[model samples]
Target: MNTNSTEYRLEGDGASIQSLPKISLHDHLDGGLRPQTLIELADEQGLEVPAADADGLAAWFTEQSNSGSLVEYLKTFDLTTAVMQTRAGLARIAREFVHDLAADGVIYGEIRWAPEQHLARGLTLDEAVEAVQEGLEQGADDVRHQGGGIRTGQLITAMRHADRGLEIAELAVRHRDRGVVGFDIAGAEAGFPASRHRTAFDYLASQFMPVTVHAGEADGLESIRSALFDGRALRLGHGVRIAEDLLIERQDDENTYVSLGPVAQWVRDREIALETSPSSNLQTGAITAWGDELVDHPFDLLYQLGFRVTVNTDNRLQSGTSLTRELALLSDAFGYDLDDLETFQLNAAAAAFLPLDDRDELAELIQDGFDEA
Candidate 1:
């Protein structure tokens, strides 16, 4: 997971974007493996891989993800999850995931991954969770020893097409105090709406567990509505399609008159965070309706309209990006300055699944770091 030593700087100001504190809300664990580690793990498990060399493997993943087909994009995960069946492999990958985030200047991150997908090697649900927690703790300790600070939490995910939603929800609540910070539902979002897991959502609500559902990426406003009313999501995963609710009535010289549907109004008025990933969105055609480039993304419009827009790297390996690179791309797309970058980080900090006092502390830390930068 070693990136180039070349720093990403804000245009005109020449400020290093990598030095600023940040928060990641939509990162995936199985999607952030190191290429070299994957090679070693696959060799150890006697599994066949698409490439023998690290560089070749990285290129294969990027190419597969950019194929413009969701099915093709998802096939890349088979190789990654193949090597993660063993406890040691899972622990090592989780450790490196945290190290990479810390290196990219992430002060806090919520790593989401489906535990049910990792049970192929006979590890129970609780064992898998514990193994990841151990690695996260080790990584945090390593960062502390190096005089850097980092904190992380697990957002246990349930596959949308599976029937284990209630089981996964209970697993999350069972480990809430042991590094699990929240619950999420991920996977195919088109035909499998959040309503399919209403029972699980009800149980989570009864237990007062925080939830964030993957909606509006492959589906439309109806899916997002179900995520809000049925799943009780506090945040939206790649909720970029929520922008479909905005209707442009007219455009004037000074301002453009627009209207918000009920769904858009509820999300904006309630300040629900949108975990927008720029590169991933384009690669998956999530923003194709608007256009085929980053400039056409609704991120700027949502931000201008006061939506709680936060930048993220949905899958570092699949997208071939980092949080630093994501921020750089966004800044390039919409003339954002250091203040704009700070605002994104602050919005993420405020939306974190942490306690109020901890959120305040995170906000202060972000402010101080931005001021210093």
Candidate 2:
């Protein structure tokens, strides 16, 4: 609805990718802060920052995230979360996050963050949730005033290395009627499989709360299996490493024959959506098993193999990307066109944690937007 032209466009026909209605399922609240906002928040908190100006701060985050170590990549969040310890900071960040997503043409988005990480200033978990919800509502209202529409929900995350899974799960369910839509477990995924939070997952299962797990990004198929079997994840967060299960038996000039292992078979057959973030995946080396380049990502392979694939910006600020930019990059790498982009949005809309009727409405909205484009 924002008619401003974006730098990202489809390569072949030059269609504006940014104007298309999109869904964001894997975006992190702490990782998507505006650089300028970070600078101001840090100044208010009397905290030291890596850069003096907004541009320098932005570059700093990008550089640190691309350091080829997940631990180093996660350190950037320390700066972000450092300034987000108060209600005003959290609400302002959430409000600005929604505004940025709306400007990028995100019609529906689910912002995920861990509340425990924001408790340093003595804010209760419920207060944190309420603050974010207030900001989201204010942001949505602002968009509506501008003659645009956007919807959002919070995905309360429990750090995988922490022991607050059950508490976070309960927190999410407690706010389900207010703003929270689902529960997720993020952080290190190798040794900290979803099984470590089995009690929380079991409780969420009993309550029928939708779940998504951050598996297959830093780990492999077994981790994904635990997310499915133990976490009962309805969707996977950056489940790109599931590509390991695809055995490429042979390849020709135009055709490639592949065998799907049980994990791959189950994921594809069951239509589990893979929240693939192209820029972030490359920066974090999540695609290293295939190659180091975007072209080496298994997105195209999975898309061709009938795997439910969706495009996302896992961390917009750290990756220096938007959903539009991610889609354009994928298009440049894999020669995708408007229809392919639309398919990714449709997949995301269908995979959203909303009711079936709401999902259908989202699908219709996406179709209409694509048709206009």
Q: Give lDDT tens digits, candidate 1, residues 1-373.
A: 3453558999998999998999999999999999999999999989988889988888888988997655567778888988988789989999999999999999999999999999898999999999999889899999999999999999999999999999999999999999999999988789999999999999999999999999988789999999999999999998999999999899889887889989999999999999999998988888988998999999998999889999999988898889999999999999999999999999999899999999999999999999898
Question: Where is model 1 more than 4 Å wrong at Cα?
Answer: none
**Ten-residue segment with the worst summed lDDT in candidate 2?**
1-10
Stretch of 10 with least lDDT, candidate 1 = 1-10
- Residues 213-242 of candidate 2 have per-residue lDDT tens digits of 998988899999999999998899999999
Candidate 2 lDDT at 205 equals 94
